[model samples]
Target chain A: MSKSIFYHAGCPVCISAEHDIVSLIGAENVEIVHLGDNPGSIEKAEKSGVKSVPALVTPQGNVLHINFGASMEDLK
Target chain B: MSKSIFYHAGCPVCISAEHDIVSLIGAENVEIVHLGDNPGSIEKAEKSGVKSVPALVTPQGNVLHINFGASMEDLK
Candidate 1:
């Protein structure tokens, strides 16, 4: 299993956050899921405790809302 | 939050399992997600470690493969 899950909405921040997370954890170590690719994913991610994009599901099962420091304006 | 998540595919087993799980946990206590309702959900569920429908995601984050005793033939 991947060490963490990165949820993004394909926004500017999300895309850049994905790149940074992938760079930090290596591509294979993290699972990247696009909320923008599927609208239903947003619901699923929220149900999983994610408030918005650029979020990370930590290995400890906690949703780390790294939402670009509350830059919700950039999220789609 | 719901006590658990029930993944169904609108199959005979899945429908019955949903009923049973709901009966056991009450409708308001469990969140039911139908994999057949949205094609994209199948991929999401698989990524969540759900091998097939009629599966259950436990509160502890464990995917219980209660796939109707593996009677996959009935799954759509």
Candidate 2:
């Protein structure tokens, strides 16, 4: 299983997205990182060019900017 | 009992925040509005000046911009 890290900055949307991602990818596979609060997450998020909160970083180091929109259908 | 409508645009953060708000406020008191998909939400969001996702609208018509940061403490 590929490991995923979710980088966020405390936005409510980020909080909400965390649930969907966990539901979609399983909690065991995903790590929730709050950039402003978590140590080292700020640098990591910066490296990924995360301009917004609730970005998803996949195992391949691909950062997905999920700032647009999501649905139950999108998650499933 | 107050009605809260969560306006979002499918961002992961918004999704994650939705879970927290529900847990904090109870699902019965909250309504999730997807501005991109839900009819009339876009107009409402625009009127509310929601430039970002994961905004919360209270029964009093107060718009809360949850774009910066949130913690478990902030929610509780």
Candidate 3:
């Protein structure tokens, strides 16, 4: 039930983001719910209000998602 | 047996590529293998020498992969 669940669809960005989060929270602190592999988890994520991939469900039950855009250099 | 198989891990690029390929060949002609979703298919993909996502396996057993780099304009 650690699922401080990180829901990912396995994009490179998602992969990297998961790595960073795990490093911060410690691997044992989180559960990775892959939306692609775990269809059952999809409903759980949706219940948490996840409408996209790379979602993180905090232990407190809030859903956090991301949108990758141009790199900093591109912002100029 | 339509698996002109397309192996993807659900990145935006992979998603777009899959869409384009299906448009070209027709959905009925291909089998979409999501590596994250189908753990069972990973073995098949590896046997076919798939080293990355967004891979396409032709009906004849040919594997095609890509490495996305800077856009063409970036070369200037």
Candidate 4:
């Protein structure tokens, strides 16, 4: 499986989506990063042009889950 | 049909969950309240003992969808 990064901001939605993301992307395959606690998270998100949390950074360099919940079908 | 209130905070997850909620609770049955835009939203939420958004106040006086996505099964 390709690398998938899940960035979260400790919001209720982010908290809720964490389980779904792990279930869809596989816990081992996804590097869960808490934007509020992780160092350089803001900088990284800004650099990547990510405007929101609960965002998924796919191996293809596509950022998703910025506007909606990450559907299992969409993740796969 | 009962009065079901959906409280949201304009978060991406909240934005995404809106449709799911409407589908589960029926559009006419659910009143969508944006916490940031609506007057007295904060006060109402506080009075209701709501700490977060994406919350569903059921007619039964149960508050759901505060921590997770509003599942159709759960709502029904």
TM-score for each model: 0.43, 0.43, 0.42, 0.43
- In candidate 3, list every pair of residues with a backbone clash: none
Model 3 chain A lowest lDDT segment of ten? A67-76
* Residue A43 error, candidate 2, Å: 1.4
RMSD (Å) per prediction = 15.6, 12.3, 16.5, 12.0
Grade the docking of candidate 4: incorrect
Instruction: Give each prediction's DockQ, rounded to 2 decimals.
Output: 0.01, 0.03, 0.02, 0.03
In candidate 2, what are the lDDT values of residues A1-76, reduced to their tens digit?
A: 5677877666677776666556545688778887657645566576765555667766666555554332222232
lDDT of 3 at B33: 79
lDDT of 3 by residue, B7-75 (tens): 877777678666755654468877897776766777778789676667667766655453232222222
Residue-level lDDT of model 1, residues B11-71, one tens digit each, is: 7767766665564445876788876566666666676677666776665555645424232
Predictions in order: lDDT: 0.61, 0.61, 0.62, 0.60
Q: Is candidate 2 or candidate 4 better by lDDT?
A: 2
Please provide TM-scores computed only on chain A for all of the candidate models, following their numbering: 0.78, 0.76, 0.78, 0.76
Model 1, position B4, has a per-residue lDDT of: 70
What shift in Å separates residue B23 of candidate 3 from its native position after superposition?
0.5
